[model samples]
Target: MSGVAGDDPRDPAGETKLTFPESWQVESSDGLSASVMFISGLIMVTRNRYLAWPSLLLSINSVINQHPLRTKEGGNSPISTVILGVSALLASYLPLVMIGPQKQVPLPVPEAQ
Candidate 1:
């Protein structure tokens, strides 16, 4: 029997063959979103953070609700899930690393005659 990433074993070749395990997907998405939220929240806490929050929230929501945000679109593979999860987490961190640390500058002092 051919199995996809998150397909129901009972219906191996149904219309929803490539579906992910609801609970697993939810957990994975939540984990990914949480990681992303942390990274985003750390970066631009004021402006960009709010934008990033939705992706994180949606990711978590998708997981907890077991709702399929993205379709399989192909055959299933265990590695795919790992890749997806890791990619999501890593993608979030990339921006943080790119921004780097904020530079500090010492204030100039007036010279005494």
Candidate 2:
């Protein structure tokens, strides 16, 4: 093959460089954020203080770890995750604020021998 025709091993003139479409480019996965969001949703639904606090922390982590350029287009936003987390936290703890903590009844003490 002629070098001018790019059939030669060292010839790059006639070779068309392959380029994937912009849409074909792989975007970064949002698995951790998605999981955090899901957990936030569960926390909201259950209003469990134990789960709510950790879910908020995970949501913050997702925000901190997010990369704008590599993130998928039209994907879920980290801000939304944070909002959900805050909402979950509120849902878990708001009752205590509005209604106050329940007073514990003291058990009867036995007389000392």
Candidate 3:
């Protein structure tokens, strides 16, 4: 070992060998997109306006973070996730647009004795 970082007696250069996992063994699925899709499904089922907006944003993030080059052949597309998210957003808001939001009236409660 020498004071210089690249100094190696046995080898010509002290460049360290790095081992990477095989490409086939690596997972190509995007967890973010999957979760976003799940959220979209929830929004569709519940028609929650709050969840709809955030789920749409998450879908956009998923699309932006997608790496086509890194993904394996025939991998799941982010486009579908975005489409689902957008549809969920539409479903949540369309009711408000069509019928408008109803004001909730609280029932009067009797005073406790």
In order, how many clashes per candidate? 4, 0, 0
Q: Candidate 1 on 1-104: residue-level lDDT in tens?
A: 66566567566555553675554232233455445445444534343434454555554554554334342434233344334444455556667789989899
**Candidate 2: Cα lDDT at 20:** 68
Segments in model 2 whose C-alpha atoms lie over 4 Å from true places = 1-29, 101-113
Tens digits of per-residue lDDT for model 2, 2-36 = 44554576666656889965543346558888898
Q: What clash pairs does model 2 have?
A: none
Better of 1 and 2 by lDDT: 2
Query: Which model, 1 or 2, shows the larger TM-score?
Result: 2
- Lowest summed lDDT over 10 consecutive residues: which window, candidate 3? 21-30
- Cα lDDT tens digits for candidate 3, 1-113: 45876465676575568998655433657788889988899888898999988888988888898776677677768898899999999999888799987889998999999
Q: lDDT for every model?
A: 0.49, 0.83, 0.83
In model 1, where do residues sit more than 4 Å from their true spots? 1-74, 106-113
Query: Which candidate number has the best lDDT?
Result: 3
Ranking by TM-score: 2, 3, 1
Candidate 1 residue 92 C-alpha distance from true site, Å? 1.2
CA error at residue 60 for candidate 1, angstroms: 17
Instruction: Locate the minimum summed-lDDT window of 10 residues in model 2.
Output: 20-29
For candidate 3, the per-residue lDDT at 6 reads 47
- Candidate 1 vs. true structure, TM-score: 0.28
Residue 62 in candidate 3 has what lDDT? 80
How close to the true structure is residue 72 of candidate 1, measured as C-alpha lDDT?
A: 40
Error of 3 at 79 (Å): 1.4
